[model samples]
Target: MLNNQKIKKMHKLALYESGEGKKHLAISNYYRSDYIGLALIKNFFLTTIAYGLLLLIYFGYRSEYLMENIHKMNLALMALQIIGLYIIMVVGYSILTYIYCSVKYAKAQKGIQEYYKGLTQMKKAYDREERRNGRITGRRTKA
Candidate 1:
């Protein structure tokens, strides 16, 4: 015979493995997507900063070379071009990341809703079985 603790544990496990479990899993996935989006954004920011610093260093070296060789290099125009390129790259990457993460989060939430609906159906079926049988049983009795 199943003990009270065992029965309770089984019921809990059953509920956890049902639609409720899916909902919990989907919530976790949603959080994970947020974290991933944050990481992506952070990485993009760091990379852009690094690229800007490198560009500045390169421009410094190039300015000295241009001063020694070409007497009329347009330093201001070159700097503006580099800054504009960096801004464009960062904006494009941010937009792409936002779209990808939004899609991922939406899909996760949809999965959670589907699981919740499945659990509701399962409960309804269990209730109907119990009502028909008068009590839940592990085995059927032959008439």
Candidate 2:
């Protein structure tokens, strides 16, 4: 699977080298991704906001339902336990996001590098062809 991905990337670069289109890979890889960091920050903000909104909605409904646990959270056990659970959840989410982003960024860089490598190969091929053709004054080398 990984080999297939690499070959696909190489083919894409070769296409670019052949002047198929502007290199999207090079453009994307030019910038520092900070992909995982940004994702973690965004996730933290979103998760906290979502949890806060849920708390608000629960309390608002509780006022109507007239429940005993009006403002309390369902921590279940001790404060330490709740904190531990929160830590674990956040850490797990962070790890998953980091892995995803890292893979994407690395792949992007890989693709662009392959593209440049392909271009180098293409340049060499053209040079050799030109040398062999001897279209102008130079004598063609016998194949």
Candidate 3:
């Protein structure tokens, strides 16, 4: 959404000042609001899917040989070999996805904070201008 900043800027510029314009402004306002950022969501969901798939693949393959032989100790070592590589891969990717999620989460939070700060400043500016224009201007700032 932040990546669409230029489009947002242009949209703000093409103000028709209708009720539709107000709704559009509200939508963009929330888009840039301090609620959620796209990157954090993207990474978290992607990592979740990847990790889920990895687990499913691991357990599915493991089940093939072990379901019937679960209580059998004779083929334990053989099962371990087949399952060990999957474990290693899952662990590695799990760690990687964790690191990625952490970074993306922080980045998204920073973006939200910055966006809210910017929105606050904008509301202040708008209120000041409205006051100058002799219009009621105390709603957002009072919040």
Candidate 4:
């Protein structure tokens, strides 16, 4: 009565459901572009906050020197430089986030495909069993 193949598949499904399968399933629910875009947005905000904090710390550390040279400093150039650096940081992080998210989405998709394959096999095993026991006497109907 034991279906070894079905049992093995059930165990695999259970293992996946209890592990990274949950995350993969969740990720699979989103379109690739949407997932990547969301990650990019999150990275942008985090990068902006981190850059702001870095600027604040730098300013605080050089507060005395900055105050002494406040009048001599080219304020416009300093502002431009800071803005340029922030832009670069944001762009670099966004690119990395995009790539990472794309890979993650692809991996999730692959995992889901394997899970579905196992499910299909399980269904076939059940159908085979039912047919063997004469439980399914009528023509099969796809639901």
Indicate which candidate wins on lDDT: 4
Considering only N, C-alpha and C atoms within 3 Å, which residue pairs clash in candidate 1?
none
- Per-residue CA lDDT of model 4 for 1-93, tens digit only, reads 787877888999999988999999999989999899889889999999999999999999999999999999999999999999999999999
- Residues 1-143, model 1: lDDT tens digits: 43475456556657666755665574555476665678577869876987779887986978778678665767788779887988878877777777776676666666666656766765666566556576455555443
lDDT of 4 at 122: 88
Between candidates 1 and 4, name the one with more favorable TM-score.
4
Candidate 4: regions farther than 4 A off: 135-143
How big is the positional error of residue 79 in model 1, measured in Å on the Cα after superposition? 2.0
lDDT of 4 at 49: 99
Predictions: Cα RMSD each: 8.4, 8.2, 10.7, 2.5
Q: Which lDDT tens digits does candidate 3 get at residues 54-118? A: 76887798887768767765676766874686566556655665566455555555654555565
Residue-pair clash count for candidate 2: 0
Candidate 3, superposed: residue stretches over 4 Å from native: 1-75, 135-143
Q: All models: lDDT?
A: 0.68, 0.64, 0.55, 0.91
Candidate 2: residue 23 Cα off by (Å) = 9.9
Global fold similarity of model 4 (TM-score): 0.92
Best by TM-score: 4
The TM-score ranking, best first, is 4, 2, 1, 3
